[model samples]
Target chain A: MPLLDLRGVTKDYKLGKTVVHALRGLDLRIEKGEIVAIMGPSGSGKSTLMHILGCLDVPTSGEASIEESQISSLSEKQLVELRGHKIGFVFQTFNLMQTLSAQQNVELPMIFQGMKKKERAQRATELLTMVGLADRVNHRPNELSGGERQRVAIARALANDPEILFADEPTGNLDSESGGTILELLKRLSTEYGKTVIIVTHDPDAAAIAERIIHLHDGRVVEEVKNA
Target chain B: MLKDFFMLAARSITHRRMRSWLTVIGVFIGITAVVALISVGLGLNKTVEQQVAGVFGVDTFVLVPKGSFGPQRHAGGSSDQYALDLEFLKSIPGVKVAAAVRQRTGFVQGPTKADGTSTQGFLPVMGLSTELVNEFESFTGKLTVQPGGRLFLPEDKDVAVLGADTAERLEAKVGDTLLIAGDANKELNLTVVGIMAPNDEEASTGSSGGFSAGMQPAQSKDTIYVPYDTMSLLWGEASDVLVTLVRTQPGADVDEVADRVEKELNARGSEVSSITYSDISDAIGTMTTTVSAFLAGIAGIALLVGAVGVMNTMFTSVLERTKEIGVMKAVGARNSHILTIFLIESGLMGFVGGVVGTLAGLGLSALASMFIGRFFGVQMAVVASPALILITLAGSFLLGAFAGLWPAWRASKLPVVDALRYE
Candidate 1:
């Protein structure tokens, strides 16, 4: 079985008196260790798809499966547990807690998993060191540069050693040089660590780094391309 | 997990120090008012008990005219008409000694000195039987002649004793001649055989009503005492005994004696009521409880205001940390985790407020007691028992948690998608 599977998945939201369709009849499969990008325009349902695939939301109809388990039938608490153990999310805004140090932020995911303090601390330090922020472990988000904050967020996402890492416009806020470094780090995460990676973005340059690109338009997949 | 939530809560509260402090101050003021008012009320209650005990002595009861205990009623009749049957009162089962006291306000002239001038003052003149004078001496050690003076003997018909303040005011000492005049314009001459000590004066004065009257006895600092026979001789058969104080055996039940006295007096066609020290002490206890409860209720309003203030602050905190909450949810924190964090934060605010408020209240009570002692001549001590502090602190914490419930629920129930979208 593929790492993630979706069949005829549909999502709808109520905007006051109107029903807005965010996703309609979507079918997709992502294998383990694949670097895939979901590229679409602003209203093309890329974010809605990411939310469902990450277990942060449920589809209105049809089924979504992570590993071999069906996600659509899961309760809120079960979904939270699944998300904590199986998926890691990196946001475009680098949403790190301002009051927490880099090491503490990285340890948050494992903390929720009830990891032992000494072990989580050791893992947090190693993860920060792997993200090239070993010297900045004690620095809070406010004290770090934008790129460094994003690095800390990336380190945090990998804390639980999730099966799949999801990045929603991960480098959207950084300059091109910093954004290039982030994309390289994400690419290496798939190539070197054998972790499945999903990136959602409108930037072609970001999509170019993915091994597979799926283009979405008006809540439907329009094209699929495999990069050399 | 709880520890993590506690740490998160602490960090959040510390992140917004100014707002947290303001919220705590609101609660602190409420708790302070409650603590200070209750402490003072308890202190006053205790002081009244001590004063009453000191004035009335132990195992003692009083019998007063029936309607006299209500208020000073001026019925259109002579004061001499309301007299108790001394024979019946002295015959009560537990009566060790029943003393008949005739109280009157009269003018007494001090001795003419070498310069031929005398000072005069209107004072409460109590006429006691010679036997009762001895009872007073036994009940309260040595009522007359503190050091250099003489006690009133059965043969001493026209001698008088002066209260300490009255003696000082009249410039009269032991053996000084005093000219006493009754309200009926009858006059007599007597020598001051003794000057009573200041503390003894408070116990010797006659309290007109029983304990239920709740009246502080007339200040004995300015008064004179003469034998009841002398008062009756000068005023003729018109003199009446206003009140009779009956003492029970040391181990006898005072309340039972009082009830029997009332029953016997009523059967004899005498209109009178009786009260014991227990009655007055109970009344004082109830009065203090009511006052404390009333003041605490007012302070409770302030506490409710403080709770509302905490709710408002928590709501604002949840709003301010919306994005942070989203980030937490995204990082695998459950709704329960978010709820726990916020609840702990508000509870900490209340707990801190309780501690500081208790301290502030205790300090204020101390200061109030100092002023009360200086101005009222009564020492009032704050009852800052550990049990009280523990209850206050725990109460404050629970109050905070209760106040934070709605806001914390709202925070926990927020959708991760919407929270992330919030700016």
Candidate 2:
């Protein structure tokens, strides 16, 4: 069975007097340990699709499921639990809490999961080390380099040991060298760590690291290709 | 879990140090006003009550004619024809002792000026019954004579005990003879027996200024005391009883005895009012409550403004941290978690204000006590009861939480995606 499946997924948003369609009857599937890059323009519903799959949002009128549990059938509480334990997100701005140290930011998700302090602290250190930020554990976001901040965000994303990792425009805010390093880390996470990595980006270099690339336009997928 | 939430709240508060303290000032001002004003008012009331209690003994009751002034009712009458029935007063079950007081203004000539000099103008000369010759000191509890002098003895005639200030004015010493020129130009000599010491309680009560200041009808420090029969010898059966004094047995409830005495006195077909120790204290208490209520009105208004300030601050916080809220939601924080965190933050602001305000209030009350003591010569025992402090702290916290409820709910209800995208 596919690790994640979507069928006829649609979402609509209302702004003032007009109804805006963000997604339209999109069908897709993702298997375990696969690195897939979803390439799309600004209005191509990339965010809406990523939100549904990450459990941050639910589909408007279709079935979106992880394994056997349908996203539409889950309660608000269950949806939050699913999001918390099953998926992790890395944003373009590297949303590491500005007030927290790198290690503390990584421990945040585990804190909400009610993990013990000493245990989560040890794991946060290990996650930071895995993201190649072992020496910058105590540095705050303002003190860290752009690359280091993105690594901290990735460390935080993996804090709860989630099954799927979503990187939204992960390289958009980084210089080429730092961007190359982040894409390399994503490839390594999928290859060695067995995480099903999903990259939502308009960057060709970000798509180059993925095993499959899906193209989207105007709220629907248009083309698919395998990376060389 | 709650600790973690509190830590999170503390982080947010510390992040915006200036705004948080500005919000806290709004609350602490009101708490400070309430705490200081109420404490000072209560302290003044307590201080005056203590002074008045020391001035007048609680175990004794003084009964006077309703319309009498300065304990002098008439110019001439025997005990039997007097306004009050001394025998019936002495017959009361709780009445351990009774004394009939007679007082009037009279002229007396000192030893050097006797034959040709007219005399000093009329001053208050009070006479006490034989029962008071020794028992008056014990019954009154606060009155005492100088160390070298003695009270007038029952068997002794034509002797006087000069009040503290009156002795200074008269330049009369113990063993000095004063010739009294009576109603019909009759001459009498009285030896100075005892010179009364200054009443410290009366001195304090007399000098202080407050609403209840001078509430205790202060006895003149210039009065002269003599035996009841000697008064008749001086006045020739003309002086009438002005005030009646009754001392109740120790361990008897003074209020109960006072009520009984009041009942008996009222039954005499007169409109006289009998005062008890509780009456004086209650008068002070009423004044304190009135002052406190007026202050509480100001505090109520201040706290209302403080509440609005807290609500406003919380709403602004929700707006300012919109993205932070989104990040927290994305990280697995439920809406209840967000709500609780914001509530705790606001509640903590109020609680801190209460703490600081209580300290400030205590400091202000200390200054007020010093001012009253120095300027008014009134000793004030300022007290901030632990109960008041605790209640104030708890009340401020609850008020903060109540004020923050709507804002926290609004924060928690914000759409996670939009909040993440908020600038």
Best by lDDT: 1
Model 2: per-residue Cα lDDT over B1-423, one tens digit each = 788888888888888899999999998988888888878877878887787666457786666555332233453332322345556767877888877666767886654544555335567777777775445443344445788898766697789888877777777788888776557776678899888877677543443332111111135567777787787777765235665667799887777886787678668743344556686678778878898889878877888888899999999999988988888888888899899999999998888888998899888998999998899767798888898789889988988888899999999998888888888
Evaluated at residue B232, the lDDT of candidate 2 is: 76
Residue-by-residue lDDT tens digits, candidate 2, A8-107: 8899989899988888888889999999999988989998888889888888998999989999999889987977898899999988788789999999
Q: What Cα-based lDDT does every candidate model obtain?
A: 0.83, 0.80
Q: Which of the CAPRI classes, incorrect, acceptable, medium or high, describes model 2? A: medium
When candidate 1 is compared with the true two-chain complex, its DockQ is 0.59
**Per-prediction backbone clash count:** 0, 2
Query: Could you give candidate 1's per-residue lDDT for residues B86-132 as a string of tens digits?
Result: 75677778988887767677788889978989998777777766666
* Model 2 misplaced regions, further than 4 Å: B56-125, B129-150, B154-248, B264-274
For candidate 1, give the lDDT: 0.83
For candidate 1, lDDT tens digit of each residue in A1-228?
A: 999999989999999999999989998999999999999899999999999999988999988999888888999898889889889999999999888899999998888888988999999999999989999999999999888898999999999999899999988999888888889999999999988999999778889989999998888888999999
